[model samples]
Target: MESHDRLCRRLALLAGTAVLAVDYRLAPEHPAPAAVDDVMRALEWVASRPKELGQLLPGTGLAGDSAGGLIAYLAACGLAGTPALPDVLFLAYPNADLSLSLQSVSEKGEGWGLSVQDLAFYIAQWVPDASLLGKFSPVEVARAQPLPVRTLLATAGHDPLRDEGKLLAEELARGGTDVEYRPHPDLVHGFLTLDAVSPAARHAGDSLLAAYGSLLSHTAMLRRDRNAPPDAPNGAT
Candidate 1:
């Protein structure tokens, strides 16, 4: 988490947003659902004691990249129907299926810096229990339900998890979720962290931030209207 501080600051500034990053526990020591539990606990603490971390959580949305993306969507699913349900979900190249059996696994799995073998090794360390993979899998959990009001799923051209992300995006949209799918044709996995050296990655990153920020403001307005008194104007400012 400490390693992401600089990127966190960058995201906040570029997106015109305030961030409350969770320093969740890691795998091999703290495995599957531990990160999910940690995030929920963090949210609960802040929600119960808003004054302790005022103005940070506007309840607008959730965003995550890579493995964290999977956890974020799962957490968002858990928050469904609650007031904490994010208005928008932003997932950048999420590791959708833990099984690593997606079609792209063989297509782009080789020479992409992130291979199926590597994924398998990490998944074992994180999950440990083969029987629990389906329980912790977003791809499995998502098939039975719709996502939040809005969902943004981005996929990399050469990422092994690309097809699963694309499939989930389509499924969410078909289920009446307002989905936005962005595919970076030239970029690969972990492009978010490579924006410093790649202009295309930087552009994509900025575009994502702009879209998410805009959605947050729009949703905030709608929420305010919904909570307003009946006497107020239809489009009250």
Candidate 2:
């Protein structure tokens, strides 16, 4: 969690967004659905305690990287139609599909920090059952139903999960959801955490945060315009 704290804080500061990072349980010890359940409960608590949450606005969203991204997507899907549902989703190099059907997995799976073998090992520990993979996959869910919120997907060119994230973005767009896709060709998986150590990763992280900030700001402006009093003068409250 500390590895992600810097990135989360930077994004929150840049976007004027309040972020609540969850310290969910880990795998092999607390397998499938434990982390998901914790996230759902955290969302519920956040939604119910706006005052404690820095008065989060209506456009509050979720952001995660790698496996965390997958959990974020699942939690969002699980809370769909409920007040706890996030208004937007941001995924950074997320393993959107557990099926491992993407070509990139074989192309760039090794030599990178996150390898296909590593992914398999983690998945097996977290979700030992092969049948439940589809149930927890965001790509499968997106193909079956429309994602209810705007989405921003950041993929790395040399990542095994790149294709699946792109596929999920395409599927969401086709379903009429507002989707913004950004691909960082020079980076690899887990760049978000590596940003502190690498200048290139830091630059990519800055760009991602800027885009996210713009989205939130624009959404806030639109909401304000729509809710303004009809008789209010232009440029006046």
Candidate 3:
């Protein structure tokens, strides 16, 4: 919720890309089932209004960072085969594992912006039962659905959640999802929003822009082909 308004401003600057950021209820105040439920409702509401996005929707993709990334994944997964199925997913240093066992968690605790303890505290405040943890984490999805969506996964080499992001990307690919992984060797977590002091953070922002362009172009090409006249011959059949 802190960054959704910022994302909306950023999206306005982009030509063909449109982003609809959800403002889910925060933790402790509005924990677990309520939080996830709020996210689902937001997704449904946004999806119900395709015209609000102009052309950057339906086949358009999803993107998020940190906790927002977690929500984006769950939203995208929930939308699979539905009216809102995203054509691609862009994740930056996502909080894929609430378990917080990634090596970077311990190694880059102070520098990563988001620490294991912070994540634990958030979860403690939000999640109702320990058993529900597995359900909330996208890492436990085990098998990915062939939504035929491409993914852009970026992780900071020095971040505490690096391996989890990497693992998530690998699992997506293993499940037949197209994934593009970027690991910034010199950066830490929360670089996208705090790039003023981190050069790598600016680079990541640029990379995300590029990834959005790629996916948009790909979607456009597919649209063109699908809408082409029947008599207009395609080289393939």
lDDT of 1 by residue, 136-184 (tens): 7788887787775688889999899899888778778777889899998
Taking the tens digit of each residue's C-alpha lDDT, what string does model 3 give over 182-232? 888788787777645657676677667666767767876887789777884
- TM-score of model 1 vs. true structure: 0.91
Clash count of each predicted structure: 0, 0, 1
Q: Give the root-mean-square deviation of each candidate in angstroms.
A: 3.0, 2.8, 3.6
The lDDT per prediction is 0.82, 0.86, 0.72
As for candidate 1, its clashing pairs are: none
lDDT value, candidate 3, whole model: 0.72
Poorest 10 consecutive residues of model 1 by lDDT? 52-61
lDDT value for candidate 2?
Answer: 0.86
| Model 1 spans > 4 angstroms off | 56-58, 232-237
In model 3, state the lDDT of residue 21: 65
